[model samples]
Target chain A: MDKKKINCLSSAISIHNLSKTYASGFVALNNIDLEIYHGEIFALLGPNGAGKTTLINIICGIVTPSEGTIMVDGHNTLTAFRAARSRIGLVPQELSTAAFESVLNTVNFSRGLFGKASNPTYIEKILRELSLWDKRHEKIVALSGGMKRRLLIAKALSHEPQILFLDEPSAGVDVKLRRDMWLMVRRLRENGVTIILTTHYIEEAEEMADRIGIINNGEIIMVENKAILMNKLGKKQLALTLQNPLSTLPSELEKFNLSFSDGGKVLIYTYDAQQEQTGIPELLQQLGEHGIDFKDLNTSESSLEDIFVSLVKEK
Target chain B: MNFYAIRAIYIFEMSRTWRTLMQSIASPILSTSLYFVVFGAAIGSRMGEIDGISYGAFIIPGLIMLSLLSESISNAAFGIYFPKFSGTLYEVLSAPISSLEIVMGYVGAAASKSIILGLLILMTAQLFVDYEIMHPLWMITFLILTSITFSLFGFIIGLWADDFQKLQIIPLMVVMPLTFLGGAFYSIDMLPEPWQTLTLFNPVVYLISGFRWSFYGIADVNVAISLGMIFGFMLLCLATIQWIFKTGYRLKT
Candidate 1:
């Protein structure tokens, strides 16, 4: 049996031991394995130079991998590349388009290149969905940055691919545009199109991804359901403003490992936010028993941004 | 195998020719006419026939070969290079179409454009002086073969070039010089001694000779050798292209 040739029984994309080493000997991706299930919005979260685009390009067939086996929709990326590629469409991070070609013509060209029959109605639908139908006849050079981005999405969706990759789709997008793009992504997912988007924006992933995969320094550090990941990695901080400044803390309250700042004006305790017993009430009672009194108290829960920053910073 | 993809690329490239009609189709005809006037009407009328064919008519095929070579190279080179430069080639590279299909689309369109331009120049030659294509079918064959072969060569240049200047280097510096010296304006047989043997090493000589043979049934080299040279060059280009896709050359990294 060939260990490298693993079956993708249920994975939309199954990557096994993927690694890409460029001619310069720089390892862009190293010993990575990931699986994206069908009909889900999977956000690949990573920072600058984090191999997000390299991974997307490899899966999309633009960049070849030095070592790995990638199966796209049950087709091997190397041996059955045509089948694999036909099933996927990629909206690259760069804003590349033909300046002289019209918007509609470019979409039609993309569909044809992907071996799809010409469908004017489908092209029009995607264009209109992306708010590009009105500018269809205009030369791409005349379009604004936002319209051009929309045109890229239109072209990617032109072929009705089973899997779509959006590499930093929201790089230069506005709030409204981003909202609309997400709406369209939702519509695609509703139609059973698997979407794997790469974004450094934690908010984008938090709002859209069903599952989140955090990649850092050419490796995937974590993959989990969005809610479970946030809950697990997130932190909660309890801050207490003392009624009086204290020169020192009593050893009875030391068990909580609490720290004081602002000249002992505030005491802080950090704990896992996801745990059923956060020890918050016990800590408060212990402080009370230790004769520590606070005038007011506040609590803060970490966002996905904090989790992402901590993850990358740790790596 | 993807006929639709091939048609799409071919139509896209052909439309570009239409958009730049002045530069693509018209300019070549205007330049070839100048060649017929200076080299044909001016010089040929003052000179005697070579191999019993009039000097003006003798240079017709060579003159067309000159433009065909340069046009085929530049057209295909620019067709692929511009996409690479502008970064739009990612879609095509990521598309399901095979490497062979992409080559067929680009080289096919470039050859078709050169063939049209070559035929137009052949027609323009009629206004200058009288001539006859002794083997009309062979004339079409030579025109097509040369266009396709040179277009394949140009596709290699496109893949090899990283910058716009590099793209022009082969067409302007290398191919142009070769065609001019490869018996386009004069017969290599007219050369003296080892120079004539040296001229045979220029592959363009065979192309021009074979193209001229189709016109006047006179050739400096055997027609079979000319065909072999063009086919041989074409096979090399094809193999290079295959290696390019296999290695993920400039197109991938």
Candidate 2:
């Protein structure tokens, strides 16, 4: 293999032709081929039951795929399961813990499950980082929801895995926990760990992901650099505040796709921002010709949320 | 063999036993002691001796075996089942540990609990009746073998069951009834005609007869055949577990 091929082969994870069909005949994933680069944060964006969890479970070896192969750092997941699995850590979507177990012991036990020796200092560091050191001796049943979620993260990072998958990390979490989780995720990324997270939270992907892959109905519809995707698909909205509130949009401005908002005090025109001509100039000229006067005007570029909605809605 | 991983699971499970000391350890011991008091002290004294051994002494091994079977299955089954129920099995599944290690961890801890419970019940039984082990080494062998075998059986039940009620069904409905009919309380020799032939077909008879023989130097069946039966059952359970892991039956998709 050439140098570039070697580099691709050395990627954190490479999945080829992966597919899964449940016993009940539901196709959860279909021919998914993906390469996650080392030391990069990759976000899988999908709707509910879009096969995000299925794909992650397959790679984690918790769910068997009906067909295809997966390699983690050049080890085949099926044939070299232990080696492949040793490199990965999965924080599942479920908020599960051994209810009677102390937090410290639980996390320590998780580290040992990966064959790591007991390192109390390292375990302490993780506990402190997650702000769980104070509750280390408490049973899991006594912890609040947010604390339990953090404990899950502590357990995932206990063995210091190179590749981490956070399945819906922010689901049902309070804002503070979500903020802390993102901060910790960024810190992990900075330390050269490859992070893969699945979420329907567009802003999360916009803030944390370097690349975004959109999955829908057991298929990868698109994968692109986060910046490129937003720039390419994002739209711009031109909002004009009218001097007089109109009961309805006049047919004279029908050439422009304009809509009335805020009791007709605002005229909103949405256009593709990526186009060389956004139709703003023509809309303005037409508005002047129609004798429509505006007291104030503002232009806003579409957010990642808008781009994500348009992409999914297009399907 | 990933001893650390095995130790991790084993210790976690063992700690759970400690956390539920009353239910896991005390309850079985207390229940078995009641059997000794009711059957051994009150009824056995009136029933006279069997095969030159006191009736109270005769029932000791069978009573211990009874508790051993039920406790082993329940402990092992519940240990693995709870992880599955709570979704924590995903962590173990995704870890670097192998199937053998997983089995050893859970089955080992569960067998240890049953053995300890069996021993405690023996100590409790001594308070009411005097029973001696004719072959102390063989007695320990049978005790360990029974615990491990039934623990393996329970592990399968844990995997096969999708709900809590299903977990209890086999132990309560199947194993318990089989143990009662397996000559635990009475020897097969006391049965008349075809009943003796039919009792031989019950697998638990061999387990109880073999266990009782280890206590009194006498058995309802040949000692070799009884050992063979238990070992055969062990192999069967082991094979079933191996297949379950290979096909990723309930553990996987």
Candidate 3:
């Protein structure tokens, strides 16, 4: 199965020069180019009204593109939409569902809607995986909000799509359910499904994403491996407590313009963690030469959330 | 072709009708029965015969058309409209099925329901007034054609409507009035002067006349003209649907 997927495709999804402009002249998405690989969990991070939903909608064929084209597994989303859409599934952000429909029937409806034949055994498998089998006979309106979110996942996976787009899957969900969703996502990746999700929860991406992409103001600012992003952009801070208070930094450290707090009783230095020369050694040597002594020294590294905040702030 | 997808939608919609049995089948049948009791049994008796057929029997086809048009429109309209109202339309729009298949599934189901309701009314009318079918096959044909035509129109109303009030505007304000004035209770011959000639302008007149001709072999308009008018209205509806899909008017952003 893995060999067949790569026989003719370079990437699972490829977007080129994509843009969407509403009739009201609102540019929902700018010229965007991106490539998503197979068997990888990619998380898209963005703030409110940042075009995350619009981008996901366009790729899923729910919204038409004003200009440019999208191909899903080498199939153009428009020209060969049947071939393209059959291999993809989308779990929308809204909790809008058939309030009167049974959970089992609605899931079956989605599978048939994607042109797949009936497979009760397979449907039962997904239902059990989402922990919805017990509530399968209940109407969707009877389930709790968390269960409805899980039902959306069951519907998306009903047809066994190769690529899944979950738009804010964890929104309004409890911690236990979020963890369960993350575990399910990882399991899907292991089975060779390419997953793309947009989330405001930095921890979700930090824990689940193999790669991360940050989008802001309708444009993608950066896309990098999760580990590489954290390391490259992660800033480390060194805090030193002085043995005696000083009026200010010595003349030799004036060029660095180091930050001092607590009435000059403490000194702080920040530098890139990944760089070979973080300037920490140079600063300490200069401090020793200047006779600036500290009784205590501690270092702190920034988390993924800090990096995300700084990146969005920069743009 | 996505026949499997089409079947799924068709079955889903049909099940909605089954779930709301009182509204879908019983309400229309009960109301049509009321018309038979008042007009076909009471007023129709004193009204006496016209063109050799009893007044009660003459209005049977017209009464069936009245319910057929309204039921077809509302069934198709509400079936699609509820999904939009509840935000479930996204799933249908994003599905791999084509627009044509979507129409077939919805319109097909609505028309089937209307035809069944029409036949049920026809049988119920027999209890109030005795009637004969001069052309049984043509009677069934008119039932099928009128149901399909009005169902397509209803689908358009569903797509165009944004609210519940808008959904009812066409069926209540437009279709019901037209049917009432389309000679549903009396033949155009009873009207005075140019009014009889002017009645041709009402499109419903053709539908009711063609259907009456199928029942009693008597009609105000020629059978061919009535058939042509029905086909014309259906084509206009089909063209409008094609334009809607092409522009992605209400379905897409």
Candidate 4:
């Protein structure tokens, strides 16, 4: 391989025009195009039936695609599955570890499955990182739900994969454990591992993702840098508390697109977040000039969830 | 198909089978003992000689076949089906192990169990009757071939079955009926002409006849014909199992 090929191989994952239709005629993925960098945390957000798992399944070589192709670490996923899969780790949605096996053996066996020679230290590190080292000798059936979930992460990372796919890692986890998982994900990224995560938790994406992909109905609606996406699509809100309640908006204040709320004691205005100026001062001045008095003022910005819902709705 | 990968899967499966050692070893031994007590002692006393051989000795081959067929099917079926039932099949499917490796591991384990059970029953039958192996080499060959054939059949049953109930259908509905009707207890020649000719269509007859021929040097059907049927069934099973692996039947989707 040449230098360019080596560079491409180091970037972790890429997918182009991938599609899958089940035997039952459900189109699980439709023309997905994506590229994941070597060390960034990428978040995939979608509704219940949005094909997140199917897409992951295709890239991992679990589900054969009806058309198109995917490349993992520059190796074609279908033609060079072993090499491709060796570099990618998958944490499946289902909690399906062997109940009769101990935690340590389960994770170690996963490493051996990848054709890697045994490395006790590597296994220990993974178990310790996932906070499962102490329970390593215990049978899987004896573990709590939270511990089982953590063990899944340990198993996925057992082979020291360059990229890890987490499918709703925190779906049923308590808030504290969820935070711990996020921290572990960050540490993995710092070690030059790429992460692609799917979740219904918008806050998780907002807090962790460097890039966000919004999938709806088997299609990716948008993929953008998190900050830029927020700046471009996020809305800003301006609220003014009235010194006295009113029955309706002032006829002059209507020109500024201001609306009344809180029983007409507050005048609310929404505008683009990316604008050089929101024109909020002019609107407040107009409210004052129109004899609308305010006792206090507050401003807020739209959350990622708001942008997520609006983008999905737009699709 | 890598050697180490095959070894890993084989060893794992063997360990799993060994975990239920008591059931696999004891159940067949105990069942065969009942056959010896009820059929060989009580029934054979009145039945007299069969083809100049003691009635107790005549039933040995059939009893061994019964044990082989039952254990082979259960081992293979439970090996694959339970993994799927517990959702661990997904783990195996997702691993770097190829379909061939998975099949070989499971079928190999099942065949081993069948051979062990067959051998144990043969040894236990000796305690009841003074049976002799007419052709030791043929006996070993038939034992191995039947074990592999039946184990593969069990694998197909595992892949086709969707639930625990579906898994049981083959062992109970198909295997049991065929074994009983296939002349495990009596020679087909003893049946009325029509039933004798009709019994020819049952595949289990070929296996039992071939095994009995190895033991007594006498068979209802030509030994070559029995061997051909066994190999044919073995090939059919291999092809079906290979197809199952290639298409991801029941394992995927």
DockQ winner: 2
Scanning candidate 3 chain A in windows of ten residues, the lowest lDDT window is A1-10
Selected candidate, larger DockQ, 2 vs 3:
2
What DockQ does each listed candidate score?
0.82, 0.85, 0.81, 0.54
| TM-score of candidate 1 against the unseen true structure | 0.95
Root-mean-square deviation of candidate 1: 3.5
Better of 1 and 4 by DockQ: 1
Please state every model's RMSD to the true fold in angstroms.
3.5, 2.7, 2.8, 3.1
Q: lDDT by residue for model 3 over A17-80, one digit each (tens)?
A: 9999999999989998888888878899999998999998888888999998899999999999
Put down candidate 4 lDDT per residue, A193-252, tens digits, no spaces: 899999999999999998889999999999888888888898988888889988877577
TM per candidate comes to 0.95, 0.96, 0.95, 0.93
lDDT of 2 by residue, B103-124 (tens): 9999999999999998899888
* Model 2 spans with C-alpha error above 4 angstroms: A1-10, A245-255
Of the two candidates 1 and 2, the one with more favorable DockQ, higher being better, is 2
State what share of the real interface contacts each candidate retains: 0.91, 0.86, 0.83, 0.40
lDDT of 3 by residue, B26-140 (tens): 9999999999999889888888687899988999999999999999999999988889888888888888999899999999999999999999999999999999999999999
Off by over 4 Å in 3: A1-9, A241-257, A260-267, A285-297
Ten residues in sequence with the least summed lDDT for candidate 1 chain A: A1-10
Tens-place lDDT digits, model 1, residues B1-253 = 9999999999899989998999999999999999899989998899998888888988898899999999999999999999999999999999998999999999999999999999999999999978998899999999999999999999999999999899899988988989899998788878998999999889999999998898888898999999999999999999999999889889897
List model 1 lDDT by residue over A195-274, tens digit each: 99999788999989988999988999998888878777889999999999887887777777888889899999999877
Best by TM-score: 2
